[model samples]
Target: MSDVGRDIRLVGRDLPVGAAAESYRALVSELKAAADVLGAVITSHKVAVVRAADDLIDSLDPVAVECGEVNALRREGTFLRGFARDPMSVGRVVDEIWPRGEHVVCLGAGGSAIALGRHLLSRPEPPSLVFADRSAAAAAHLESVLASRTGVRSDGSGSVEAASAVVHVGPGPWDELVAGSPPGTLVVNATGLGKDRPGSPLSAEADFPRDAVLWELNYRGDLALLRQAERQGVERHDGWQLFCHGWAAALGPILDLPDEAATARRFAELAAPLRPRTGGQ
Candidate 1:
């Protein structure tokens, strides 16, 4: 269990329904009997404790939010981590797309989007990031918060000259929002649609440059959109790498893991219970 970051194991019941409680309890009970077990992190990705069994698990252990339920679980001492509903891991991928940028357009005002936006602003000379959503009120709130911190206007409407990256929150249609864009634009998908499903962050209507990098944030397995990008002559990035990026980003506060090359290798070798077997066969 002490395989660097691999020491962190994600455990959960097979289904997103009721019976998982007893199953989870059994798993915990078994782990407690082990020698080097440190702590457990219950993931709240699909829903928050509505499953009768998950509620039971929540009653017994600490939980981690997948989409951004930090405020909801703040009193519970749950730490914040980004989980992209989209196939690509947006925060980590965006960091790769633009290590430093003038501006970033973030579609969707969910938890992961806000978390990444905040992380960006925390960087020394952070990029000007914008939060956009169908809910005008949601976007307005995020915009106000960012404007106060970074002093850049977050009107959610402007030119790429004013922004460098455009991240779509979910698999929702974002091409309409970015129809008018300059070339060499950096587009990112922050939604969870492509994680275990098929869909692009942007729509087929808009013309995303072939040279553009079409990154999906899901970081699970092979995504349908990856093939689409390949056919379109666009470069595609695997989603799992983003998870590695995220783990590295969160190493300091979450696990305090070292960042040396060997440390990374050791961390990758560790088995993570967080990953699930997709398409239940």
Candidate 2:
């Protein structure tokens, strides 16, 4: 493989966000001046890292600024740059699957919610968005954030509330959200219920749209949502592709690549060696 085309090593450390607040000084102190380290990929302190990397020649991903996940980091000349690319991954994956004329109902208004909302609005013929979260305020905040990004007021001429295209839904009515959406609507499971913990977002009696497309943002572990979608014969997808492109996009700029696709292609070729030798069953 060429120098730029080779797969860059991805090292990870899982630190709790709460602890990051208390230990940030010591943490960064330890991480500083580690020459072999391209950067540190910190999941828990996503927003904190982005803010810290803002000054000087270092770069931070705009998506990471919006949502708080899948950040790519690299240090250059004493500055650490952080980038979040999950939104791009969502765009690429959704484009290949549903493309146009698909209203999207994203379950959970967290980082993925922000990613989905922004991408849906940017499409040539943007799909309508509905953010459903256990917290009503989070859903509302997502709508407001997307409105600002889309260049409209919360209730402006083309804003979510004005046209009724995008709605922020609270808990206990998830089934209603699903039933109300158009058939073939894109339903995203951005919540950590199934992966980070046990259980599915939708209740046992919840029903999906007639031909909905379900995108569960978890590759493994308890996959109640994926199984539910499959049982209903829905077009379902997992997080593997999202994971690949997200990392590719996040690290693209750091690696001096022009675009996410190139990074992804190179990584795919390199990862081929790790699949078969990968054990566990």
Candidate 3:
């Protein structure tokens, strides 16, 4: 299993959803022996488990079903494949901005950082992208990996690869990063700081460029980032829509749904009533 920082595999008491404290290796063996391993459902924090599964597979391969910081995993035939579902939401959310900015910066080089950066970096005529984290190593690892994906080959240390000339990766203290952003910039809070715990990634002294779009990935929480964005009077969005798209996209491959406009629209319509309100008010 892979994680950005700490590895808190499971949280709280097992409750009724109990499972053994088996090693990832043992779990993979069990999964392989099961009657027709359909697919695996994964949450972000459990990503390392999937990576372990990928390593254990021999007969078939592990494919990445959903792409983002964390991916949904499944087995095919003797192949390990990785799929990113987050891009479906990422693209949609960015499109709503009508005209996109010349730059896109993602704060926090966690799982979502890799997934989001990949999507943004791969687009034709992509905007200049920056991913900054408190840990230089973490930020570099992300940058190196992302850059290498451009057929550039990264050293896994997040060094800036020359092949991917458009991106700028760096360390955190994002206030300066935010302050220098161009107007209409697209800024994302992928840190999971405010959502899971509390506090904003940016300091109160940070400046948001005019007409920028602020996207808070956690729909519900004590969101300090969203409040700051709102205070700055920028166009703001919560992750509710993105969350819907993520599930739909992840399930698409599993349920064999068509990747059509109608399908996406239908998914959104169905999910709308179920999505809780996430305004900072």
Candidate 4:
């Protein structure tokens, strides 16, 4: 808001991970009914909210439809608009760090993983993507989502030629995936463990790939994974840039901002002081 010179207040809402569809519907209805609520940024409930309140949203951007998630909401008169801004935001952060055709290991196969995979696979030279999740369902869902969007299928085995694959890390360690990745791989923690939950995706014993770029998608928290990266002398990036770019992307339509990049830069400058001085920095 400071970047745009608008007086806007952000309120945080906490919802359980597997909340019922009706609960999300009620929340969406409340936002629509509230006159003062200009817009909202959905966090962990991106997919759940969209699935539960698809009828309540008047418009969904193409990305939202494709990704089956909604991360931003805007109310226009009687209509509430939904958008999936993760792709745009995650793309901004990834592009700054990723070179084409490198390997990428995303720890959590959730909404953010879908967005990141979608963006990366769409590139002319798609990188080898390996998505890992504790839940087999989540990993399968990510594979289906990516296949639907990119028309590229993963052949169960994570062959380089497949370009995309999912691994179920149930009752096992994430260390193997990280250790097996080729040098210069981009390892990402898309899991909400550090912030919304506790602990790191990779255990302390995990060995990071040589010349790996570690990306922890949480700017504030215990950030155990980030600390581990720093300890190993890996190049690291936190989610601060993604957070700024995501808000700028969402606010573009809500507040009708003229330049999203400028707004994001301004937001970063303003929020820099408040950012946690963690290992990634």
Give the winner by TM-score. Answer: 4
Cα TM-score of candidate 4 = 0.91
User: Which residue runs does candidate 3 get wrong by more than 4 Å?
Assistant: 1-30, 33-37, 58-70, 75-82, 149-173, 260-264
Flag the better candidate by TM-score, 2 or 4.
4
Give the CA lDDT, 0 to 100, for residue 198 in model 2. 76
Alpha-carbon lDDT of model 4: 0.84
Candidate 4 lDDT over residue span 1-281, tens digit each: 45586888888888888899988998999999998888888867898887789999999999899888898899987689998888888888788867564788999989999989999987766777888888776777678778854445554476434455555657545899899999999999998888888799888999998999998999888989999899999999988888889888878878888998888998888888897887774
What would you estimate as the lDDT of candidate 3? 0.60
Full candidate order by TM-score, most accurate first = 4, 2, 3, 1
**Worst window of 10 by summed lDDT in candidate 4:** 159-168
Worst 10 residues of 2 by lDDT: 272-281
Number of the top candidate by lDDT? 4
lDDT, candidate 3, 1-281, per-residue tens: 11212232322222111233255556556545655554443445434454455456443222132322234445464343344565555666556643444677788776666666666656544566777676665566566556644544444587544324233444445887777888878888988877776888888778898777787888878888888888778778887766656655655554455663355566567767776566622
Q: Which portions of model 2 show Cα errors greater than 4 Å? A: 1-8, 17-20, 23-29, 42-45, 48-70, 149-173, 266-281
Can you write out model 2's per-residue Cα lDDT over 115-195, one digit (the tens) per residue?
777777776556667777777756665666676655433533464432224655655547788878897788888887776
Residue 163 alpha-carbon offset, candidate 1, angstroms: 8.7
Evaluated at residue 67, the lDDT of candidate 2 is 64
